[model samples]
Target: MIFSEEILKWYRENKRQLPWRDTRDPYKVWISEIILQQTRVAQGMPYYQRFVAQYPTVSDMARAREEEVLKLWQGLGYYSRARNMHATAKTVVSKLNGKFPETYEGLLKLKGIGDYTASAIASFCFDELQPVVDGNVYRLLSRYFGIDLAINSTAGIKQFKELAKKVMSTTNIRDYNQGIMEFGAIQCAPRKPYCLHCPLNKSCVALATNRIAELPVKLKKSKVKLKHFNYLVVVDANGQTILEQRKGKGIWQNLYQFPLLETKEEMAAISLGQLKDLGLGDHPSILLYNERPMVHKLSHQHLYTKFWILRTDKVVAKAIPWEKLPDFPVPVLIADFIKRFKF
Candidate 1:
């Protein structure tokens, strides 16, 4: 059976009833694509809806503050996406005169948009014959074709993308694109894929050869680097705590966090006065009360974090929006700290 036919048949019966799928609006499609990157559908859907509802147009998003955008994207991790979305919105409004670029190449020029995003926007919105190659699509194609190349490698990505484009039906690019993606997301899931019910099972090379898992190969990731962070939660008698915004191009840039001191490794000794070594301790009052250590994992880093609660009489100078900490939105990691420490 032809690849497009199998996908089309499966999509008609199993495609998700997504709002973005029902329309050809470039703006909505772009928003969905970006939010869905490194994010599950169940997780990305609410953020997509809220973003579309809050900022209907690129100009509206462009004019919004980064804090406001990040606030709306509080729970959703990979904050870089929110920042990129905000930056791209401003670019679209300013560079394209409030109009989303209409072609694949034009869309690719936008900040944060890559080949996959460009293809999705182009095919979905303009019916352009461009193919999207996300992890789902990669897995499906590799399994069906029995390709052995590492899917995450630079060369592997190029090869798979070429193969995907070759199989993409030009007659109805929009439906074809949506059909393949839907087929991958549902029928050809990464684990325990329903090979028996799959429309392409007859022609799937990986299934016939008993190499389903081995075919969709990926390069092993480097070991996660362990880093330690000591957060200071200094509170005045008014129940308000000092919060700081991370700066200078490291992880969590521009995001609000507690006063932090990063050490080479986890510190065995826990003391209030030790903060002076990290450029603290000058405050008039420093009463260390409680300490909690959390291990937060990211894709490339494992964060071993410890928070110290200290009582102070005044706010520190480096704190972010100190008077308006209540107004600023915080990530769950920070929110949990506030709830437990009680200022």
Candidate 2:
């Protein structure tokens, strides 16, 4: 109980005044939790504000189009999260009568709601006795208890979950969960934690053992594969540009982008002849070509992208006015090209 008491004490004095913490609204909590996954608070805060402003409620999000949701989540990178959140919103509205699931088990049934998110929503919104074990919790608990197990391993996950449940306050589970997560985020940080001033310094096993840097181990990530993309920005004399929706299960799914020609590697040589081979009609004029390819790195893939501006007399289907390009949702890579080219 002392561990919970100390963490709550520290939280009361040091917790950041985040927007999501101000309300017990399940919808807002769900949005904030999803946005903050694999994202830092400072970076995700604006997106949360924008999402809440645009879609004030779960029903509002459910009624909105996927294109509109993807447009708002343009730079957030994880396109699947946007798609899943949209699907879950619709489910909540259609099936649950717009009321978010009140229990951890019920929340886990929703799309994109994992154990951590479900536990967060259930406990924070409904005050359920569920402990959240996110990255922050893993770090704080692993270090404080000096557990050497790899946090990603099955044994470590089970052990940490049990420990988290044990330490969580029954009467104040919401603040206890928030306190420990916040404690890890600020005080017991991944790097250069404030051990000297920590309230639980005397009891912290890692601090006592001088192993603060080594307690929370993680498995090494798999190698990132490289992909080369050649995007053709096709435009006709009428200033209409063609955009296509990505149809497959891959990065940027359901988002709009320029005509893409993926090659085994960076094209050995790009020319009009190669353009014809890529299915573009013959005699397409190359107005501009970025000789220098831009590199965009994702978690598991590194993309080498080159954008070429092509002019063709032949009519192209799905062509929209160039001035109205912003009306559609495109990947950040394509968006950057548009901004740079002022298209």
Best by lDDT: 2
What local lDDT score does residue 233 receive in model 1, on the 0 to 100 scale? 71
Worst-scoring 10-residue span by lDDT in model 2: 272-281
Clashes of each: 0, 0
lDDT of 2 at 266: 90
lDDT of 1: 0.81
Q: Candidate 2 residues 81-169, lDDT tens each?
A: 99999999999999999999899999999999999999999999999999999999999999999999999999999999999999888
Q: Write the per-residue lDDT of candidate 1 for residues 156-217, one digit (tens) a residue.
A: 99999999989988788888788888788888888889998777889999999999877689
Q: Which ranges in model 2 have alpha carbons more than 4 Å from their true place?
A: 271-281
